[model samples]
Target chain A: MGLIAREIEAAGLPTVSMTSAWDITEAVAPPRAVYFHAPLGHQTGPAGEPDTQRDLVARALEAGVSIEQPGEIRALDLRFPDATGWEATAYTPEAIPMSPDGKPNRGAPREPRA
Target chain B: MARPADAVPYIERTRALYARQAPYRWVVHDLEHEPPPWTPIRSSLASSRVALISSGGVHREDQEPFHFRNDVSHREIPADTPASRLRVSHFGYDIRDAARDPGCVLPLRALRELVDRRVLGAIAGPALSFMGGIYSARLVRDDLAPRLRDLVLRQQADLAYLVPA
Candidate 1:
């Protein structure tokens, strides 16, 4: 997708890209509309979360159409501060491993699976 | 909404409603010359082939989830993930049913809308998906790039509209 961004633009059409991972987005530095979302795997918004989905789509469209100049880049300004808002109620971020090899072997009591 | 039993690799109809919001930034821009000289894209509501790359540590239930504990590890789901077998591993968004309708995030319907509006050609037949929590981007450029390149090639895509989770 990174390499294709330029070629796509070269074909005369603009592009809008998304990434929840800040590092990846920053590195690719795609040459089109880009958004750095807070949630992972939910850039388009949350599934079954209609409003969130619509908002993201609207923003992406806005990013694509908002471009006036030839080489303009816009990053969607969206954030979630509290869980009261659109927090992911499904998946959870695994705890960081304290081991040197990057494996989670802390022997922490596992939350009994449902 | 239940994710479809026969769906794409993406999560079903989930939505992202931002709680706080981020400050907009233009890290680069230069779209006049031949190669455009590192110009940044636009920032408003424009139209384009928006592809999504979600992190939420998603993976198929039948297969192993990507490294969720690592901050710099990631895996890409080809456009051919058994639409129905996809699932989210991260606890960021409620993607229960969204994997069934990946379009909710990739917006294949919206892409059709854009196509109807004369904005773009066509949505990439097989849009892409990813598992998040990757910290180091070196692998993205080196490893991820080639994999994505293959996807674009297989789909004959002109552009890649990304949606990161």
Candidate 2:
């Protein structure tokens, strides 16, 4: 999503990413972003909390325009409940063959030793 | 909203949302481009047109749902669409909060309020929503990103807020 933000900004538009994924936000480095320390699914604020959510959104919109630096991330202090309650929604990939040192081998097949 | 079934690995969970899933190791991309210079906000929010965008997998009830199967597609939601008529469908994170309050993920309601309160100039039309679990940069760069660019431009949207769920 930050990648897409970059593209949109590249198109001569100003973009601000109000995102919860700081690591990825830093990785993609959009023009302007406000790191909401909430949760993955909730970026504005806690669920069913409209006033707080609106406040956060208002702050973010202000940041979108007031921000001066490129790739700037203004970290907010809004903390959500612990994520320990959330379920793992990850999707795993296929396995790869490992080498003796426990490193996965990506090279071509080698001839058998005599 | 249903409770999360297990502890969420916030780190790995977000990483999987868009990172390439290499079988051996995590592959990170150095997306460091020459960051665009600081462009000042287009006057006041009450004057410049604002665009609302989200990565929360939101769409209109009548439109086709986000293609989580492909994961690279995006959807366009009309700005006038009410929050009650909107819905979310993404697998990256627990969608319970977003389901209960789409504003939690998209902030559409807040954006609309800004308009109503005269805090914003106007709400740009055809806001965007897309599945964010895309792992391929090529898909983002060459295809999906360009489509988003086109949307912003076509709408004549002066400022855009991208709320990534």
Predicted complexes: DockQ each: 0.19, 0.24
True contacts kept of each: 0.24, 0.50
For model 2, the stretches where C-alpha displacement exceeds 4 angstroms are A81-114, B1-33, B36-38
The residue pairs found clashing in candidate 2 are B46-B121
lDDT of 1 by residue, A1-114 (tens): 333454444444345555443333333445554553444445565555545555556666566555554433455666533344333332222222222234343442221222
- Per-candidate local distance difference test: 0.44, 0.67
Q: Give the Cα error of residue A66 in candidate 1, in Å.
A: 4.2
B1-165, model 1: which lDDT tens digit per residue? 122222221121121111122221222322333333233443222333444344344455565555443333445554445535555443333344345555444454545555665556555555554543333345554565456555555564444565544
Q: Give TM-scores for every candidate, taking all chains together and pairing residue i with residue i.
A: 0.51, 0.78
Model 1: share of true interface contacts reproduced: 0.24
- Comparing only chain B with the true structure, the TM-scores of all models are 0.46, 0.79
TM-score of chain A for candidate 2? 0.67
Q: How well is candidate 1 docked (DockQ)?
A: 0.19
